[model samples]
Target: MVTDTRLYRKVTAQAWDRLDSRPARRTAWLGYDGSLPVIAGTVICLVVQKLPGGGGNKPVEAS
Candidate 1:
């Protein structure tokens, strides 16, 4: 739970926008374990890219 109002508001707004624009990408689940609600899931990488470098791969030396 977020205690800071400003942070909470910012996160809420971002969530609302994502929910509106990408509803299909959202995931939700509800379960009970001994009268207690439990939630577990995994989040995969959303974006992956290569880093900029020279042609040949080489290790840098420290002086």
Candidate 2:
């Protein structure tokens, strides 16, 4: 799908604003340092866990 550059930028800016305005306080005690990697890893894990054969077997990669 194609996205318009101007609209994308506007939406991104608004999202950032809302994200920054969120009420939750960031903490370092939970192994999270308010980084994107933590969020990405959480989403990936959730998706993998929901997929069939996710825990049973993994696809072998070719070297």
- For 1-63, candidate 2 gives per-residue lDDT tens digits of 222343222111111121222324455346655543322111111112233333543544321
In candidate 2 the C-alpha lDDT for residue 8 amounts to 25
The C-alpha local distance difference test score for the whole of candidate 2 amounts to 0.29
TM-score (all chains, Cα) for each model: 0.18, 0.14
lDDT of 1 at 52: 38
RMSD of 2: 14.4
Ten contiguous residues minimizing lDDT sum, candidate 2: 40-49
Looking at model 1, residue 7 earns an lDDT score of 23
Task: List the candidate 2 regions with Cα displacement exceeding 4 Å.
Answer: 1-47, 53-55
The Cα error of candidate 1 at residue 57, in Å, is: 28
Go through the candidates in order and give the C-alpha RMSD of each one to the true structure.
Answer: 16.7, 14.4
What lDDT tens digits, residue by residue, belong to model 1 across residues 9-53? 211111112222222322332342233333333332221122234
